[model samples]
Target: MASVTENKPSNPWQVWRPGIDPAADALERVSVLINRHEHITAGYAFTLGESARRYAEQCSLGFLLGLEMVVREHGNQAAILGWRHAASTVPQPSKSQNEGEKDA
Candidate 1:
């Protein structure tokens, strides 16, 4: 006798958002700093330092993936997507963090 197994769909993995994850926040912060100091626009290549090149590539990957998720979730209308995406999901920072200092 052959046995049959039922198939169940798995939940789709969500792309991590900055406001919802500390790691995501760190990634976003570094990404922003890299862009600002390097004076490169989003999705642009960095032709200077090795660190700059690597960080730029990493930032672009995260940005593209996040944009893809946002587009898929919200369709073409992007006027309010930034606000919606930034809506708080993660808990507020602790007292130490709120005091403008991060624990080492």
Candidate 2:
């Protein structure tokens, strides 16, 4: 039982949205924001920006955003899981850094 609990994978969806109630009320709100972002960025399909495209694709993978937010909110188990999922997105994170590429 201990091993089973220890092996449970951290999930980003399980992370609570700060200031938002983690209940049925938040789902549609989140979905609306997500859909709005998707619609607004759909024009990117026609744009010829390679770097922007790569950045968007990396964000699409999700772990980086989840990691950054959870890290910013102080800490969470999902943040730890994000690190485990981030090896492929190293160069990606370097670019996403707000301060500098120091962590790169």
Candidate 3:
């Protein structure tokens, strides 16, 4: 007996994942982050057009390290991409973070 899944036509662009693919998930998340910010230039690796989870916006340096780590861990079978444009403005420290500076 053929199951419903067996009858579905496979799309070449769509990857067949058994359960959850963590590598692909991370890749997509990072990719979207870089894609969203027009002025944001950062390294991102992606396995597909979008993320399995999500994309977050944050400081550049931190994001750089994070993206590099994700790519290093999941670069296998991945399409590696990178960019660097120092036009982004650094975010100001939060109130809580600034409070600690006052103590100094």
Candidate 3 is scored at a TM of 0.25
- What lDDT tens digits, residue by residue, belong to model 3 across residues 14-89? 7645236454444555555445544333333332212322221223455546765654454332323321211123
**Top model by TM-score, which number?**
3
Model 1 worst lDDT window (10 residues): 44-53
- Name the candidate, 2 or 3, with the larger lDDT value: 3
Cα TM-score of candidate 1 = 0.21
User: Any idea what lDDT model 3 has?
Assistant: 0.43
Better of 1 and 2 by lDDT: 1
Please provide, for model 2 over 1-104, each residue's C-alpha lDDT reduced to its tens digit, 9 standing for 90 to 100. 37775688877557645334322222323333334434534233222122222233344446435434433343233323333344444464445575565655
TM-score (all chains, Cα) for each model = 0.21, 0.19, 0.25
Candidates sorted on TM-score, descending:
3, 1, 2
- After the best TM-score superposition of candidate 3, give how far the Cα of residue 101 lies from its true spot, in angstroms: 39
Give candidate 1 misplaced runs (Cα > 4 Å): 1-16, 38-104
By lDDT, highest first, what's the ranking? 3, 1, 2
lDDT of each: 0.38, 0.37, 0.43
Error of 3 at 81 (Å): 21
Model 3 ranges off by over 4 Å: 1-19, 39-66, 69-104
